[model samples]
Target chain A: MMHQKMTAITALEHSVEIKAVSKTFGSFHAVNNVSLPIRTGEFVTLLGPSGCGKTTLLNMVAGFIDPSAGAIHIGGVDVTDVPVHLRDTGMVFQSYALFPHMNVFDNVAFGLRQRKFSKSEVTHKVMQTIEMMKLSGMEGRRISQLSGGQQQRVALARAIAIQPKVLLLDEPLSALDKSLRAQMQVELIEMHRNTGLTTIFVTHDQGEALSLSDRIVVMNRGQIQQVAEPIDLYRNPANGFVASFIGEINALPAAIYQASDREISLAIGNIRMTAPRRAEWQFGQGEMVQAFVRPEHIRIATSADAGCNVVTGEVLTHIYQGSHTITRLRVDGLGPIEMRLPGGDVVGRVPVGMPTQIAFDLSQVILLADKSS
Target chain B: MTRQRPFFVQFLVPAVLVAVIFAAAMFNVLKYSFLEFVPGSLNVGGFTLENFTRINRPIYYWVLLDTFILSFATAFFALLLSYPISFALVRAERNWVRSVLVVLAITPLFTGEIVRTYSWMLVLGSDGVVNTALKSLGIIDRSVPIMYTRVGVVIALVQFAMPVMIILLATAISQINRDCEKAAANLGATPNTVFWWVTIPLTLPGILSGFVVVFAWTMSAFSTPQLIGGGKVLMISNVVYLQGFSSFNLPFAAVLSLVALVAALGSLALMKLLTARLEQNMATS
Candidate 1:
């Protein structure tokens, strides 16, 4: 059965293809010339801040907004000129736009009915979808009677009941509270696994993008910055934007002291450190570069860690989270630097206004050319 | 204890005064309805049930039925014509287009009823604009009798009621969550289906209220039917005028006025019941 399904999916060229798509409103370019191809049954996320064109690209794919240029294909068929209803793609709006006038069953059955399904078939599909979404007994309830999370499920069920070729989610979890949002994120992962539909999720929350997406397309200023899996994106960001955006990291200025094929030496203020040279680093010796280090990679220095890769700074503040603590320090040339330590041990050990020695794990450090200089 | 609002007495004084005057006038009308009508005199005699019993005649029943039918037709046609205008007024993409629609839809309300009715007279009269245009277009060999007809009266009343209808419907169309329509379309519903299933249902409350309001407003319409009807299409108000002023039977006229008021109230109550049920079904708070 799995092999048959796979072959059926491979019969189509791709689940969704956007080629050189652009959308402009007056003189403002909402989405610039962009192209992306989503494989069958893969979950991709378009992650960006507001006005980054992620939503615009999703709208174009849904056929809600026509692109100013280029073509769009769903299931290997060019649907650029097709109307929204004929495109056969499902979209879950950010507002969870379940029909207020319809009961839960009707809302879920809407697409099936529109597709001219038999009454028994529509009922069977709707009930199955509602069960999958865990909304069994609430089928007769009005939309206003449901809580925010339940309404969200109904919206999802309504979109997926038709079993469209591709599913579009426009920040589906943004309206929920933090705990509920996290819970829904897990549910979303399970839903994706169960359905295995080609899905494109849009969100501005980087943590959500990192956790839920199989591959994330990070966007900035109406352009794609990078496309990679979450782990690779966090570990090896293509530029300063991705490095700063994906997670908390300190960007410190450094000068390349010496360069070789295997290792490179860098100077930060009066301190010196050496890092294993990456193939992507083509900078020469004596050139300016920016070094990025994650907070978890920095730790308080012990007596055994004496000479290289250690810097002294005054402790400014400690933010004690339940599992870990984040400590802020002020170095001489690096400005403010944050370090995350496990447990509350660092909070009691390091007092404010006292000098502390901290070491950087140079193996995980990220180096990029200092473009501002 | 609740805090006392300042100037409470001052705020209550004008409302109290108006209510007192209105109550006194209605009481006089009620008293006059039971009194005997003296021909060729403004004075009335002692109390009698004759004025109320006189309404049992078939001619009076026909007049009441005519009034109800004309008001219903006016409200129906007004709702039909105003919905598109209201939708356009609320949904026009350009600022200038909305502004133009608002001005055109509402400006007719500022003109005097007499003035507007006269304007319609010129349009509907024999050898007037309609006849002249139809003649020039060779659609008809002779002029149609639009003037002094029920059709002419309803046409004038519909135009008169459209401004209010447009305002109510426009408010309803604007309050809809646009995402609902988009969601319907996204879920494989055609544009036409989306409109019928989603947009129309969402605006049902507004449609009901607009229809009822126009119905009640047209039920007591006096000048338009009087001028345009030219004594041919005798609505309740025209009959009341004929009895009170021409025949000098104030008691029967008061009875007719009371009947018109009751009919209007009844229709409004029916509208309230329907819209309340609709609101409950949608649960749109």
Candidate 2:
């Protein structure tokens, strides 16, 4: 299965290399000195919380807005100053920005017509793309006649029909409901596999970023926090932002008491615990730090007995999400910790106000010194 | 949803009132179109189709042709002048400009049609200020005789018809989405092509309606044509008036008035039919 999926990948020729990009709206910088290379035929998502300059970077690549200072090259040719139309990139908007006046056939043919394709050529290509998108007979239908999902597919087909060097999708599926969004994600992945077109997708939804991209560039506040493969970024985030964004992570302030190749002991007030040190940075005798561990990695202990993985805590609340549970507990020194548990884990009722301890693998935790966060 | 009043009685009140008034007025015209003069009697004694058939006379044909030609000329000029002006009004973003545009577009519509036409008469009349200025510049010896000409009639009609076209075209241009223009630009079309293909087509339906409205309005207009024609240029309305009041041939006048109404209605129907076909072609293509 992995081989087939890999076979679907093309390592396509380098499509866009946005270097040292910075876009400022007046004195406020929307995208500040962001540099990321877009691999050809790879689905790269710029993921972040809102206002993180992901969309601004995508716009610079699409040439919708000029960058303050940057060099952008598509297909190895510098397109830093190219107009949107001349850049020859297709952009699919979140709103599905399909032309209301034109029917499906003519809407898809619009770009082809601009390039002066022959009448027969435009018709054949448009029909073929419509069929490829599984909208075979929708050519005669008006744009408003189609559902949201169908309109998205038509937009996709229209974008790809021109055979643009790259596709820039600005949160294309964000407007869709969850189940439909998931379905379109699969379809989009399949389309990418079939076409080998370089695509840069932007979104604030973390799950979408994780599931769709070959690599995710997690951003925070107009700057890229980390760029890594989804699995790697989830398993090992470069800093606090990626750790908290990709999944449920517990961030606790700790001081590195001692460090070695195998283990690093950290202290939070009177509580001290030792976890494996994966970071390359060396700490002296005492340095304030941030320790991150995934919520799922923590195991709940039924009783507190001064065991190896234990903490005396007062339970504040319990939330029942289907198939799982979240317990909000106030540990001795830690303010409050949320523990996620799957169904069928506990034998007795786990109600609020009862004390519980959470245990976790030492190696799964990471330490960072980005105090600004 | 049915009303309690008797069907024809409910319909007939206003219907009969209008029909009776129109019929009585045209009856006088019928008497005029057919009355034969007793050589010296100036006596409207016998009935004949002389004046109705006399429309075949060369003078009447030329006058008829000139009336249509002038109406069309005015319609074309109004369309040309209003389209861009309306575009600016629709696209203006500033609040003051928008309010000012609304006032400017509405001012002409608010004025009485004859008041506006007579205002043009003051400007166009020979030995009026226009010819007086020309006489001073030595551009012509006598006050240049342009007043009471077809040119003066056309000028008056165009000014009278302009406000309708402005409001209609503004409404049309306002209906277009700016995003469509951006989409065209993104597709590599230059700004001009976007206007020609996308913007113009969207506004065509509006232009068609406005054209038909102005066409019917000009065809039925009597005062401007009468006051400006000055007895020299005889339009259909003038002839109709002469038949009803001067000649008093009621039946012939009735036929001619009906012909005028039919002509206006026919053009309206033609406008709708052509546009519907255009819409059908747009959909299929």
Candidate 3:
């Protein structure tokens, strides 16, 4: 079954192809020259902050907003000028947009009814979809009568019942409470896995993007910053924005002192640190760059430990976060830095206002080119 | 709380005084409705039901029925004319377009009813704008009778009620979740389908309320029908005017006024019951 599904997926071209699309509103450019090809049955997320044009791009794909330039194609057919109803793309809005006057069954059957499906066909399909969405018993319930989570499920069931060519989710979880949002995220992943439908999700929450996406397209200022798998995106963000956006990172201004094929020496104020010079990094000797270090990548060390990237700092505060603890420190010549230790490992040892030695795991450090350079 | 007590007293005093005076006036009218009319005299005679019994005649019955029909027609036509204007007022993209629509829709309210009725008379008269324009275009060989007719009175009343209807419908249209329309379209519903299926259903409450308000407002209309109907279109209010002022039958006029008030309130109550049932049905289904 898996083999057959793989072959079926490979037999079709990209499910949705955005060809250098641009949307401009008078003087403001909402989305600027963005081109992305979504593979068949791939879950790609457009991750960015608000006003980053992620929703604009998704709206273009959904045919709600037309691009000012370039074209959009679904299932290898150009649908640039097509109207929304003809495009066959399902969108789950942030507000859910469930017809308040409609029951769950009718909402799910709306698309089928519009397509003139026979009565029994619509019933069977809608029932199957409602069951799949775990909304079987609530089929007769009105939208307002359901809980928020149930309403969200109905929205998903409605959108997916049509089996649209591409499912575009525009921050569908933003309205839910944090716990509900997390639970729904897991359900969404399961739903995506079962359907194997090409999906494009848009969100401002980086943690959501990291958790739920197969590949994340990080965007900023109406432009895509990088497109990579979730693990790669977290470990190797392309720019300072993506680095800071994906997770908490201590970005210290550094100057490259010496560059070699394997490693590069960087100067942060009076302190010197060495980081692996990956093949993708292109920087000249003595070039200014921002060294990004994840909180978890920085380790607590002692003065007896010998390392080329070790620094001494005073422990500022230890934040207890159940599964992990974040030890904040005021490092010399580097301002404030945070280190994440598993459990309460550092809680009793790292006292506030006391001097402590910290080490930067050189291999995991990310170096981004400074804008001025 | 103590400091605010005197200010509350000051505000309450005038409102209470005004309420007492208004209630006294209504009490006088109610008392007059049961009294015997002294023919050709301002002073009423002893208490009697003769005025109400006089209203039971076929002539007065027909006039009451005509008033109800005309009011219903005015509200229906007003809603029809105002819906597109309201939609445009709320949905127009440009600031100038919205401003223009707002001004056009609401400016009729600024003109007094008498002035507006006179303007309508000029427009609907035998040799007026409509007749002259139709004559020149050769659509009609002679002037079509609009003045002193039910059509002319209904037309004027519809225009009079349009501003309030437009404002109400605009509020409804603006409050609708725009995402619902977008979602409908995304679910393979055409624009027309989306409008009928989603937009209309969602704004039904607004449409029903606007219709009822205009219906009640037009039911009590006196000037437009009196002037445009040329005293021919006898609405309940017009009958009351003729009895109270023209014929100096204050008792009969008061009875007519009370009937008109009861009819308007009764219709509004009926409409409220219907809309509540509709909303309940909508919620369940």
Candidate 4:
């Protein structure tokens, strides 16, 4: 009860609160009951694949969509009943939505004009925002007259010119090219630091989420898989879905031989290893499990290395990625596995159709209950 | 540029043939406008400027002015009526609702113009549906004068122009990025404000084009104004009809036709100039 109270108080102190929000269209649920609290001036990201309800959740907060159940609060006030215009939130759409009918100046001046700000005040604020967005001297340019990047900057400038209670960005970088997306990502980080406004960003790209967010909410199939910092999410995912979704991981089948409070013994084909038991898993002896290991966690073992979790496999292909090489191996009974080796050591060491021995770093192994069983 | 010629170019041959026929008809009208009208004969007399001079009279000028006014009024009212229907047609969520609106807006177009005009005659007559309904409701003791007045002609003409306006405006509304309205609302603009600021401006190009199309179409209107006006409201086409078939003054009728054509083209050119500037200001292009 005390913890629940503490959580409620924390949510009140935050800038935006979504409590048990759900949205359904006919028979399909687009967003399930999801609750999250975003603190003031924090840059939070909703990371998920397509149709994972990240955008739906963001729209509910923006008031473009209403949750079928529960309430949303902004600044400790319930705003679930409020329309979009009264919510006082600013949003940057993926398409930029920069008001093609208006020039850069008018687009940025729109929010202030709606608030009935004095002429001088409106002009002053618009000019300041344009300058901050590096859109100075292009005030008269039409939306079609500007480049993609400039248009994106105008959208950002317009949304921020209102100085809204919270800012919502919906895949704002997806439309840009690779280099431009990276540049804008840096600019977005800088903007977040400069303004310190509470921001909720939605994106399907894990790299973008990792690089730009203070914390990320990972979602799948309309449910939140895990909510953690970027490093923590990468290092310690809560489930098999998140482990594979966040990065490249290799899943291998194994059977539990013995179980203890702190350790468990697992058996693969002709190899047995004991690993520390994951605190979250309760597995019985002889239970089938799947072990997930990242490419970098497995390495080539020396000939003298014995009595370790090692296996022999033939190299299928070696992909050279400038700094490192990804070696694909076909194990005798464990199927295909991959390992990342430093470029210098991998150039000629692992030839295709040759037998190679690799050892798993037992500490980094993540095990989950085998769904097939 | 180096690929084989497009197969669709073959279709332009028939279109070119149609254009030639239209041009020949226009030349015939132009030649007849220059000829003199022969009394009590079907044949024309020698070339003269008399028919052109005859149009300088105040009666013809008044008819021309009335045509312009009626066309403008019809277009204005049609825009006012069609805008809501067009918006609803494009934004309605249910398929059945959209289908019903589409049928209601476009079914008039498939009906012949004379048939539609006659239906309007029934609705606007002294003992018509509107008058009877209004009288039964005790809103008026006597039937309001609708037929044989400029108001009746304009009302019928407005209904005639609505299908085209709805189509043009619907295309514009559908092409609009809905995000613009959402963005406006998110920036603290009310729904009314968003409508005026974002929605109206973005669809300005379509609205102007639809208005101009309806205006030009109503400029040449003949049947509705002729039947509804009942000789009280005189449009240019009605005057041409009277001169050509009733008075057998084909030359004068040809002259009036030429004048009406020039007037319609001139107004279209003027509107093009105005809308070019508007499209530029709105950045719709």
lDDT of each: 0.93, 0.79, 0.91, 0.91
Which 10 consecutive positions of candidate 1 chain A have the poorest summed lDDT?
Answer: A1-10
Clash numbers, per candidate? 0, 14, 0, 0
B-chain TM-score of model 2 = 0.79
Candidate 4 Cα misplacement greater than 4 A, ranges: A1-12, A258-265, A274-285, A303-307, A344-348, B1-9, B280-285
Clashing pairs in 4: none
- Which candidate has the top score in DockQ? 1
TM-score of chain A of 3: 0.95
Predicted complex 4: CAPRI docking category:
medium
Q: How well is candidate 1 docked (DockQ)?
A: 0.69
* True-vs-predicted CA distance for residue A357, candidate 4, Å: 2.5
Better of 1 and 4 by DockQ: 1
lDDT of 2 by residue, B1-285 (tens): 257556657777898999999888767655665666443344466777674675567765565566567767878888888888898898887878978987887799888877887787888887577888888998889776666887788778888888899999998888766656666666666778888978897678888878877887787778888888787767778877886667754444555676666666877898899988666544421
| Candidate 3 local lDDT, A154-228, one digit each (tens) | 999999998888899999999899999999999999889878879999999999999999899999888999999
Candidate order by TM-score, decreasing, is 1, 3, 4, 2
Candidate 1 iRMSD in angstroms? 1.5
The worst-scoring run of ten residues by lDDT in candidate 3 chain B lies at: B276-285
For model 1, the stretches where C-alpha displacement exceeds 4 angstroms are A1-5, B7-9
Superior candidate under DockQ, 1 versus 3:
1
TM-score of each: 0.96, 0.77, 0.94, 0.93
* Tens-digit lDDT string for candidate 1 (B187-221): 99989999999999999989999998999899999
Pairs with steric clashes in candidate 3: none
Top-scoring candidate (TM-score): 1
Which residue runs of candidate 3 sit more than 4 Å off their true CA positions? A1-10, A256-264, A275-287, B1-9, B277-285
lDDT tens per residue, model 2, A115-211: 9999999999899889889999999998877898998998898888887888888899988899999999999998888777789999999898899
